[model samples]
Target: MASLEQPILISFKLCPFVQRSVITLLHKKIDFTIEYINLRKKPDWFLEISPLGKVPLLRVKEHVLFESAVINEYLDETHGERMLPEDPLARAEHRAWIEFSTSLFNAQHQLTQARREETYYKIEEDLTKKLAPLERKIGDQGFFEGDSFSLVDSAFAPFLMRSQIVADNIGVDPVSDYKKISKWRKNLLSLPEVQKSVVKDFEDLYMEGIYERGGYLADQ
Candidate 1:
């Protein structure tokens, strides 16, 4: 393994993608510093380096990296213990699910911003349909793949956390009916890495953002 200097992570307080990378870094027990930036008021230097102008830009020794998944894979490849599977087939499957997790994030965004009852239920229905396959695939083990935590768990943790937070705010239980998902969520939440991945005021900031946007959940 190469000896890597502690990397600097440029992050936004509320981004789930950034949270994924944070969780991976923490789980792997790699040394890194996080610099929080406002997405609305991105610095010129940030825009100059990041083609996408996104958060979770990583500054490795003399180089920069963008995209949460790419950064995470790079870290796993170069830094501490690997989170991905050694088997090529298994690794491919994990990567596929990681991509699927992004769709869940999209659903969460739609659900949060929905103001009308019809729109809310529509998105909720679609979300439920999406989760059915995961519910079937997840085993009785503690984490997503098995007893050990992997990148798939890190990838999906933010989505599950967001769902529970929205449910708490709206008095609706989105994942409660899915037994496997609920168990997996409980397991993920119990991990220190997942719990400490976000800022100290994460819940307050998340709720306030929804309320400020006049979301249906906030109204309820």
Candidate 2:
């Protein structure tokens, strides 16, 4: 077995950004220390380490890395496990999908933290529009690239998990409309490695804290 090093992940239990970092760590099977933080009142140590005072900062040895995407890339580069493809074009494609996934989440789900029905619909529309490309890209493939899980899958998993919450909350069946995406999501979820690394209840993670009086919106 390769010698393992301990990494400190500054994290929030429910933050998607933090979840991205966690998923990457899990995908790599890297052992890490979880330092849960409170966004309402961030720790002094966290601010010092992250500068941006964001959760999902990583401390490996004496080096510190911040921003979930940057931290994830750093982990891939430094860790023995290689989630990225060796081919240049494939690597670029992986990065492109990763960006697409994160952007979709920011556009679709982040604003709903206010838990407003109007906001939910707006996010849903954006998601519906975005799904076509992703569906086309992932159709009937074993993975996004057609054979193996890559950084693209790890990057998208967190948002897909959150999207299920949106679909459930709005009573919109994403799986029905976007069968390819649904299948892709199922494939990603079914990965034993992904299952092993997940640490939270995803349904609750998105829905529990969102609505004041929890239930689906009418006509949603």
Candidate 3:
């Protein structure tokens, strides 16, 4: 916020991490610009500034910050009502689950990218185990922790969005059975922030990526 210029978020259209940051920015109603890039053919300027050479880089004037979680934290802390809890223990718990959501995203990626049914089902089982605790944590109010949207919700929105896309395109629903998670996902997906987080053609692009991967789900 020290800079007067609008923040620019470097992104890759298919990256869930980038989508999560976009969700946070939208939820906070932050004014920003997004620059799309090809990970396969990284621009020389992008590679030069990004230490990790990753998308979702937040450029604030001359300074650049990488990593989706860090960028969301910076945006939330500086721009609007804090999405994170004020209580130390509660905040830490949310942070832990946000980190856990990263693994869920990884497993979801593996689920979509698996070459065989066995691999896909195995990944689904692992995701079930990972999502069980979150189900208990979800309140009837619909958001991750409770009635209000938080950073935790932003972290997991991408995963839920992708899952819904897979269900629509491939007949696979990783979190279909959990009643609480199902409701939570429905509510999250309904939000304008979650809805507008990705590109307009996100569903087609995501389904196309699955088919291009030649994975078991893609065939289905």
Best by lDDT: 3
Q: lDDT of all predictions, in order shown?
A: 0.88, 0.71, 0.89
- Give the better candidate number (2 or 3) by TM-score: 3
True-structure Cα RMSD, model 2: 3.9
Each model's total of backbone clashes? 0, 0, 0
Ten-residue stretch with the least lDDT total in model 2: 211-220
lDDT of 1 by residue, 1-220 (tens): 1223779898999999999999999998888988888888988988998989898889988788999999999988987777899999999999999999998899988888999989988998998889999998777786887789889999999998877787776777778889989999989988999999999889889988999889676778
TM-score of each: 0.95, 0.83, 0.96
Order of candidate numbers by TM-score, starting with the best = 3, 1, 2
Q: Which residue runs of candidate 3 sit more than 4 Å off their true CA positions?
A: 1-4
For residues 93-182, could you state the per-residue lDDT of candidate 3 as single tens digits? Answer: 989999999999999888778997898789889998998888888787788876899999999999999988888776778689889888
Compare the candidates by TM-score and give the number of the best one: 3
